[model samples]
Target: MDNSQKRILMAKTGLDGHWRGPTIVARALRDAGFEVIMIGMASTDDIVSAAVDEDVDLVGLNVGGHIDVAIRAIEQVQVARPGLPIFAGGTIPPHAAKQLEALGVEVYPPGSQLVDIVDAAERLTGTR
Candidate 1:
């Protein structure tokens, strides 16, 4: 698939207003030619709704709160849109990353390189 044809839905699962991490990732994905739809500070319901409504090929989540918050959103998204590839980054500890990985989400904790993130997006969307 062409990069422009791949849509990625990005959302923050908590109330945290820190935008630097997600903003950078979104820009990188967009620069890499993917259409990125960023829904900032969304609830679990909002995330699931956007993933379906936007018809995104992949979901990228920025989890800044407790791991359970992100986990809840991930579970809901999976139930609502099974097989929709989901990846996450932001303030995640080792244990949280492991939990997300177990749920099939590609985890990129803080300090993850932009190139790696873009690469993951390409692979997840099959645009590589």
Candidate 2:
């Protein structure tokens, strides 16, 4: 499948008013020819709903506040759509990154290159 056909659902799991990371990632994904759906500062329920309703191929989470919140959202999304590839970015510390990775989510910490993110999107969505 081509990049255009693949959809990525992005959500910020916290009320952290930081939209720069996800915004930049979304723009990169769009420029790379993928459909990027961004639901900024969303609740866990909203995230799961969007993931299911949008039929997205991948989920990009912008985690800021608590890791448990992100964990809850991730678990719900996995149950709602099994095997949906997920990756996360933001002010995640080392411990939280380990937790996320333990749940099979690829983690991109601060200063991760945009090309790497877009490349991961392609690899995860199988659009490469």
Candidate 3:
């Protein structure tokens, strides 16, 4: 698939309001030719609505709060769009990472490389 045809919805799943990580990843995705839509500090409803309304190929969540909050968003997204290719990144600890992984959400915790994220997006979105 052409990079230009790929779209990703990049979202922050907490009120933490930290942008350094998500912004960097979003930039990398954009630079790689994916149209990235960013919705900062979004709740489950916010994330789901954007994913549906935007009709993006993938959902990237930047989680920086209680895992339950992020989990809510993840579950809602999955319910809204099964197999929608949801991935996450942030200060997620090993336990939280395991939780997300069990939910089928690819977790990219701190220190994750931007290239890896874009590559994951490609693979998850079936554009690789």
Candidate 4:
């Protein structure tokens, strides 16, 4: 892991106009020395392609709108790059969070600390 460059693919799985959460997380990931590939308002195809094409170590999604959208993207990413670690954040509802968690995505709802998210990126990508 010391010789590897940890890259993270960050995507928003909806048309939601909010950029604060993902932007902040992206910047924080960058500050932590991760190469963050951001595909804003991305579809499932876009997310999956980037997850593979970008050669990313981890994938982070902003589940802002329909929970199904995030689930679809996560599923595609899993198939495209099986066992790649994924995480998600947003004002997600309890049931939606449960669904994501069931998919093995570390769900971070509103008020989740930046340190925690960045730490997750490190752990997930084995950059710690």
Candidate 5:
């Protein structure tokens, strides 16, 4: 598929209001030629609804709360759209990252490179 044809849905699963991380990631994805739809400060229901309704090829989640919060969104999104690849970044701890990885969601904690995140988006969206 063409790189520009891929669409990504980005949402912040918590009410943190810290937009720097997701904003940077979204910009990077857009720079790489992927269409990015950002839904800031969303709940599990909102995330699932947008993921399905937007027909996005990939979901990028910004988790700024307890692992359970992100997990809830992940589980619901998986049920709503199985096989829809997800990648996440934010202030996630190591244990939480492991949990997300176990659920097949790629996790990028603080200090992660933008290039790597963009590459993951491309791969997850099948635009690589």
Candidate 6:
């Protein structure tokens, strides 16, 4: 597959500046041949706008805030782009992961493997 054919929009949904996780994941995705757009510290509106404007195939959120905040952003993304698959990763607790999962957002908390995430992107984006 051509590496440039796949596009993913990555964002940080809170004030957290810890970029290690997202950075590593983004690199893995990019190296795997997916175009990744990283938007650090973005609000719900910003995330939505980028997802739409960029015409990305998937949305990845690095959540580091109250679950409600992440939920709000997820909800907004759903409303704005229904069926636009979204996945999240960060310091989310087990319960928070469950909540995100319930809302149809795939959650990959700390310690998740990069290969796993990249595989998920492929599956989610129908590239696999």
lDDT top scorer: 2
Q: Each prediction's Cα lDDT score?
A: 0.94, 0.96, 0.90, 0.89, 0.92, 0.92
TM-scores for the candidates: 0.98, 0.98, 0.97, 0.95, 0.98, 0.96
Position 53, candidate 6: lDDT: 94
lDDT of 6 at 20: 91
Q: How well does candidate 6 score on lDDT at residue 11?
A: 94
Give the worst 10-residue stretch by lDDT in candidate 5: 119-128
Q: Write the per-residue lDDT of candidate 6 for residues 34-66, one digit (tens) a residue.
A: 999998999999999999999888999999889
For candidate 5, lDDT tens digit of each residue in 1-128?
67799999999989889899999999998999999999899989999999999999999999999899999999999999999999999999999999999999999999999999988987887777
**4 or 6, greater by lDDT:** 6
Q: Single out the weakest 10-residue window by summed lDDT for candidate 6.
A: 1-10
Compose the digit string of candidate 2's lDDT tens values, residues 1-128: 68999999999999989788889999999999999999899999999999999999999999999999999999999999999999999999999999999999999999999999999999999977
Model 1's lDDT to the true fold? 0.94
Model 5 CA RMSD to the hidden true structure, in angstroms: 0.7
Candidates 1 and 5, the one with greater lDDT: 1
Arranged by lDDT with the best first, the candidates are 2, 1, 5, 6, 3, 4
Segments in model 3 whose C-alpha atoms lie over 4 Å from true places: none
What lDDT would candidate 2 get against the real structure? 0.96
lDDT of 5: 0.92
TM-score, candidate 1, is: 0.98
lDDT of 3 by residue, 16-44 (tens): 87689988898899899999998888878
- Off-target runs (Cα >4 Å) in candidate 1 are none
Pitting candidate 3 against candidate 5, the one with the higher lDDT is 5
